[model samples]
Target: MTLIHPAEDLGVLRFITAGSVDDGKSTLIGRLLYDSKAVLSDQLSALARAKHKRTAGEDIDLALLTDGLEAEREQGITIDVAYRYFATAKRKFIIADTPGHEQYTRNMVTGASTAHAAIILIDATRVSEVDGRTELLAQTKRHSAIVKLLALPHVIVAINKMDLVDYSEARFDAIRAAYLALAQRLGLQSVRFVPVSALKGDNIVTASERMPWYQDEPLLDVLESLPVGEVSGSAAELRFPVQLVARQDGSHADDFRGYMGRVEAGAISVGQALRVLPAGHRATVAEIIGPRGELAHAHAGQCVTVRLAEDVDISRGDILVAAEATVEPARKLSADLCWFDHEPLSSQRKYILKQTTANVFARVGSVDSVLDVGTLSHGQHKGTLEMNDIGAVQISLQKALVCDTYEQHPATGAFVLIDEATHHTVAAGMIRAFTA
Candidate 1:
């Protein structure tokens, strides 16, 4: 379990574990933490102290490390996303262990939205035929679909509990073949398969001798070997949503009237012209100041105060974009929405739309199509989308907002809807295109 390598000079890979309930998401993560020497001695001792044993055998329930809630511990299921951090010699990792039940699909989406890769677990037992046919759990496909929808570039289908199926190569091959077809159809860019026994610590951080047929790298090796991200954020279009207008604050630098926000995409340098969104006011970047002090330029993910050559009417909701590569501003937007409310979405009802650094009153113009999770097709003419339903929707915002399609740039292309009465997040949205 002790891994030694040169220190990883790479960005952390944020990944999430997803599949059907009891697919061993938390257990797989716990095994990774344990085998990689990431868990502390006290934590292992605490795991022993907890009475929730996986079996009569003395194997400490690995799942307990992440099932933090009492209900989750009692029911032995993950209800919400549990975040855990660990590092190998070659790379660091942030794992989001999300719930896998059908009702909690929203939690899966929330976790997948930020992840660079997804580790979709599958119980090998399911592949064994009880009758003439085998029952395939829809949740696995559901998670894969969501992963594809989020545009995640890396995907690993973890055929977990290989030991249960006697570590048979035929079984593993059958499952992998079926999964590859689904993965390709769902538009997954990169896909790999690894047979793992999370409970026995097989093929987790290190290769397992029992599964000699799996000639490829172990799970950890595959994860560390994968690229951190598809590309550098600075390579994309410059998207700076102005969160604060730094003015009127008492300081000797009273003349410091600058727009302050994090760069969501692309890069900005001094003297680079930026277009104020919605207003279309143009200005050149005169100075960029970070917490330490002046910066010659800034890239995506950097939060800096940008001083413009001329005063422009910039507000909290306004965005500053690279003049050469700008976004479309529209009052009406077409988007794919995951309905989170218990009640179906009504086209006549109103909701509050919260995009990056901005809010607007919005109403559903129409429901174009609802995704059929069972069939993996689109064609639900149903007027309303119930909870856990995803569909294309046309929305009309009270005011024009600047946005790019989710495929173009994830940062500015994503948004959420809040209920007007209850003030709860009702839906998660990904912009598709601007409506005419």
Candidate 2:
């Protein structure tokens, strides 16, 4: 088989998988990679050797392939977001396999933050057990809410381990119903459900004869058929956060100054009118330079330096946006946060908030409420947000930030919270619709 070149695979899809522990998140990914012919022969042989040494009655556990750490193998759980890459004739895919334990929910947030779609796994046989059913549903709801808050548009519910239930249609139907209810509550627009046995490799790559009663498309079929393109809202406005300022004084260039950064949203072209934030100065794009050479036009994903017609006071943390689509300056911000660190987030403690290339000193003004994933309700909380907990909080920034809605501009609306004393990232935040 020939390898796909980067330029040939222009369409790339980033996706993540989440579910309660032992829901087969890892096994499903391994099967997808294995059956899709993404794994190498050497890796396959290693896996075969490991499978040969398995316990007498236990089947070859595909999850073992992705469980990297000794602790993870011992516990049989994923603790960090394990990333895998694969490509096909149609598109290239980056899969983030995240942990399902409640304590590792923060890792889920980290993985889903950059994903365009999410795969939520559910075990068919455990859908009826009280503890099992409730936990699974709750985890699904939580994962869905976070993906939505980040403005992800697609979701695929993979009801795994169908073989354990004799590939029964009734079991698949019941689990599908429960998941549909949760998706509806969460306002998910693009959703698909598939019955799969990740361990047995049924309905994952090819249609399963064991489940002839089910007539829907297989999991891989659905993934390939889904519309894979740049999301719609991402093309709404033009916002570029200045990462660095380049200056040159040479024979070809005399006192040339440019702001270098990646376009956060929309498209930009030479001579496009730009409005600098905070300073509120208007200028025209004189030239757009990419790594290769000057470009006539640039889009959301490109990293390029922009030179303006006239020099304006611009600095790091400042945003240059289309004059017509510029947003209001914000001092106080409201955000949905996923606490990752072992230390609980405290409202009274100060932290640093990093937005794109801009790092600003900020403090948590108040802890609004913690979300109860199962009920989709909020509980009043004021003390601290523990690891893996999702909550809404208010933050007071030292300087005003120009930002659009998270749904409107994901790159600019997302931020990371760092502990002031330890200088460690403690949480990931999505800027919600701002409060007046």
Predicted structure with the largest lDDT when compared to the true one:
1
Task: Point out where model 1 deviates above 4 Å.
Answer: 1-7, 128-135, 230-236, 248-253
Candidate 1: 10-residue stretch with minimal lDDT: 228-237
Please write out the lDDT profile of model 1 over residues 21-40, one tens digit for every residue: 99999999999988888888
lDDT of 2 by residue, 74-121 (tens): 777899889998877667789999998888887888898888788989
State each model's C-alpha RMSD to the native: 2.3, 2.9
In model 2, what lDDT does residue 355 have? 88
The lDDT, on a scale of 0 to 1, for candidate 1 is 0.86
Q: Compute the lDDT for candidate 2.
A: 0.81
lDDT of 1 at 410: 93
